[model samples]
Target: MNTPELGWFKSSYSSAQGDDCVEVAVTEQSVHVRDSKDVTRRPFTMDLNGWAQFVTSLGSN
Candidate 1:
């Protein structure tokens, strides 16, 4: 998707502190993720199921 089509959401953990973090967006077809520190950088995309697993893993970390 193009930059304008993305609806980014910064992780609450990232916003709580000023440190470097990542942002994530759940798109219609896939999940879009990017560095919270750099909006212009390329983002990583993953399928819905992959995103779910990734989040599940994060909770365990």
Candidate 2:
């Protein structure tokens, strides 16, 4: 399925470090992420709930 267009934002956690990171945009249907350096590439996306779980899991690291 084609991803809906979104205005992705970079993670605040990585802001101080500069642009070598991924940016994200979350909508009601899914969360989209793409390499900041390569906006033209296909982004990775997951269902909202699944993305939430993934974010939660990241905090444990």
Best by TM-score: 2
Report the backbone clash tally of model 2.
0
Separately for all candidates shown, the number of backbone clashes (residues 3 or more apart, or on different chains) is 0, 0
Could you tell me which residue pairs clash in candidate 2? none
lDDT by residue (tens digit), candidate 2, 1-61: 2344687788777867667888888888988988876777889979989998998999999
- Provide the global lDDT of candidate 2 against the true structure: 0.81
Residue 37's lDDT in candidate 2: 69
Mind giving the per-residue lDDT tens digits that candidate 1 earns over 1-61?
3365688777676657645887777778899888766778789989999988988999999
Q: Which portions of model 2 show Cα errors greater than 4 Å?
A: 1-4, 15-18
lDDT of 2 at 55: 86
Off by over 4 Å in 1: 16-19
lDDT of 1 at 50: 91
